[model samples]
Target chain A: MNTLKDKATFKQAFIDTLPVMSGYLIMGAGFGMVMNSYGYPPYLSTLMAVCIYAGAMQYVGANLLFTGVSLFSVALTTFIVNARHIFYGLTMLEQYKKAGKEKPYLYFGLTDETYTLLSRPLSVKNKRAYRFYVTILNHSYWIAGCTLGALLGSAFPQVRGADFALTALFVVALVQSLEFHKRNDLPALIGAGATLLSLLIFGKDNFLLPAMGVIVALLLLLPEKEAKA
Target chain B: MTTHTYLAIAMIALVTALLRFLPALLFSRMERTPRFVIRLGQDLPKAALGMLVVYCLKDLDFTSLQGYLPATVACVLAVFSYATKKSSLFSVLLSTIAYMLIMNLFF
Candidate 1:
């Protein structure tokens, strides 16, 4: 493949990702631990880290797999959970179009952290290499963290309540979503209401899909807000 | 892992990658992103993430204090920590510990 030989860009990329490294390692390990606690293999967690790199979705996906949830629900949940990436891709279209050989990977590896880092103007001589290295470094930190957590989980399989990490994760996301998105109140209310209603109606074993349906239906019917300049 | 599980993971990965890739592929040739998609992108996440929070708490038993108290306290802690510190790691870590302690000690 294309060898990115610029050490300067790589160094800059590495430094930029140091914060993400700590977060990814801890979060990825938590994902791995959760999966391992459910009796899945470490390789499975590693595979997820490689294939599906989204942290929130990985935790959700592991729960789905463990529960033997239907494939349709899996796809639907993934789409809803990851829908934000569409906007991220929209914003990056111009930059990635010129990415050449790295276009596909750069697109695939565009997690939230990588996208945030790349959105900033870079001082490196090779912007392309910087972009690629940033993506690669963030990805590697995630994989390493997953592997490390899976091994640790296996060593101490008695660790109860690790699965609560999933709840904490979604909680953090919900908090951040509310914090940043000023107009998020109505939609958030619709979401919680629809989900609680579904759970009560459909019971514990199967409420997610219907809850998602109601949320989507309700949100779509609402008038679109005026576009910002 | 079972083949079914692998299939499910593949589906998740495919959909996620496609979501990230489709905008670039479709919109590169278009003048501007469709208003419908843009609106959905902004509004859907808030709703979906809120749904996820409720989904996570679905199993909490309301009839008994033990079943629901820990989760309630932990969730409140999570929200408070994230709102104040804005550190996802610290919030998640702190709330999870609080959850484990409550679950082990009381319920």
Candidate 2:
């Protein structure tokens, strides 16, 4: 038994995830409160938290739900919002290949936080249990927060401007990505410019797909060295 | 939940799960994928984050300082706070609380 791996138990997983516990609970509660303020039920909140476990999309979803947007819009926008998970899955393909019975749920729950936690290099005896428990615990924390927030929201509705947290969260993500890739802001710049251009042409409600299309076309056009770099 | 609502939730879940599932299924099964596709995946995330940041701010009245006051201030605060404090929780909490106060007091 390697001492380094630490036998990744539920206790270890729980301890490892303590930081995420605070983060998830607060964010989840915020999402729940927003949904509740939109007059969504508690069950709906938990159900979304369980199924559509992507935090950013779920946060954006409250707006979608409130507006009662078209199903096509919901499907298309969500694909773009959570599209980064494709990269995550690319890296995780080998590791998750070992997920076996837990594979489907593993893929379903591979939210950003879970991807970060699971992708850490951990030498373990049973990698499956380690990954599985962490995934389950994280999902449960989110569900708990969402459910509580929905209940509170159902009790007292009118909490406007709380959705600003969504913008804040997006900024944090953008900054984090920017800081990580200091020299290569070209792609990022292209994305922003392309999106704004598309939005101007297509209008906000119909701009997402076109914006993503432009981003993809431009990204693919980058030289191999520049793109990979 | 209404039947319509349930359908929306289910559709999102199914679509999102499929997004995560496709690469795992495709790359593992196929012997060759285009170099450009892999490169795009490598580079897309940072760019996508940038796109999303713009998308979030797109609705704001960015043409003037006053029309976009609270949101602009909060976004700048969030970015700067994150730079110094290096804590997402603090940045998010501070900017959000600051935005709420500014909106109520001034806006």
Candidate 3:
């Protein structure tokens, strides 16, 4: 009886995550290609995709690795880039309590897409099994994408400006963020302004760290009015 | 050198997992999330993404068309495509392909 139920849960999980499958495949491939063009091997991309698993951070991390940044810088950048996951975890606190042994992995796999899916009221009977399958399946899609992309990138390493995909990715993220949190232009403006200022004052050679610092400080200092819930 | 790369990857993975784990840990021990942390989480992402976009474009040289044109056009396309279509894959794929085409064909 349990096995039959589990099988049904797995099927539902697969269907639920189909949309993420497509998104992860392409975005993961873009990250893999960027890593390959920067001279990293395909296996390394796979390793990062499996371990780090965060989309934007992996792209930024590839660039940081290419430039040979220090480990402290890597840690700092990872925290700043992925801080949004904090909110994801908070929201999942109750839903994941019943997750039992799967709770840790559930927390680890709480990505933007997965969070969106899970946060929606569940229709499945076995929420725990469904969540686990969704997380694992989405992860597999990302790994597949990263591996395929790396292989393709190695085959055609001469694809110039493949790195620009990272820029385009961030642009998409920025626009999405704006739409998600309507009337967020002020913070966005502050972010851009701080970065440009840091870029000029600190110089291109070493601007990211200061820009990050300034952005955090300004945001903390000037809080926006909380939206009515 | 390879060891360094692996070590950096490990550090990044650790930090990232830690951020994902933070709220879980705190909430498990407490009743609710503090207002400060919630506010930071709510506001930080948009600004961070904005900063990242500028970081990505930091190398654009304004002195020549070849240096900045492809990036500028692709970014504009990315913004408009995402705004109208609301499909991340379509917007990213289109802009990236357009950037590559302009770079390869014209320059």
Alpha-carbon RMSD of each model: 6.5, 5.5, 6.3
Pitting candidate 1 against candidate 3, the one with the higher lDDT is: 1
Error of 1 at B54 (Å): 1.7
Residue-wise C-alpha lDDT for candidate 1, range B83-102, written one tens digit per residue: 78987668877887888898
| TM-score of the B chain in each candidate versus the native B chain | 0.68, 0.70, 0.71
- Classified by CAPRI criteria, candidate 3 counts as acceptable
Q: What ordering of candidates by DockQ runs from best to worst? A: 2, 3, 1
DockQ for candidate 2: 0.47
Task: List DockQ for all candidates.
Answer: 0.45, 0.47, 0.46
Top candidate, metric lDDT: 1
Which ten contiguous residues of candidate 1 chain A have the minimum total lDDT? Answer: A154-163
Task: Give the alpha carbon lDDT tens digit for every residue of A84-202 in model 2.
Answer: 57656765666776556778788777776676566545555666777887888889988987888788864544444555766676677667666355446677788788888888898
CAPRI-style quality class for the chain A–B interface of candidate 2: acceptable
How many clashes does each candidate structure show, in the order listed? Answer: 0, 0, 0
Off by more than 4 A, model 3: A1-45, A54-103, A106-142, A145-153, A156-166, A179-183, A204-206, A223-229, B1-12, B23-28, B82-90
| Model 3: per-residue Cα lDDT at residue A200 | 93
Task: State the C-alpha lDDT per candidate.
Answer: 0.78, 0.74, 0.77
Candidate 3, DockQ to 2 decimals? Answer: 0.46
- Badly placed stretches (over 4 Å) of model 1 are A1-45, A52-142, A149-153, A157-159, A162-166, A179-184, A204-206, A226-229, B1-16, B19-28, B63-66, B81-90
Instruction: List model 2 lDDT by residue over B1-107, tens digit each.
Output: 56667777877888899988877778767666557656666566666666767777888886766569999899999999999997766787788788878877776
Model 2 TM-score, 2 decimals: 0.68
Candidate 1 collision pairs: none
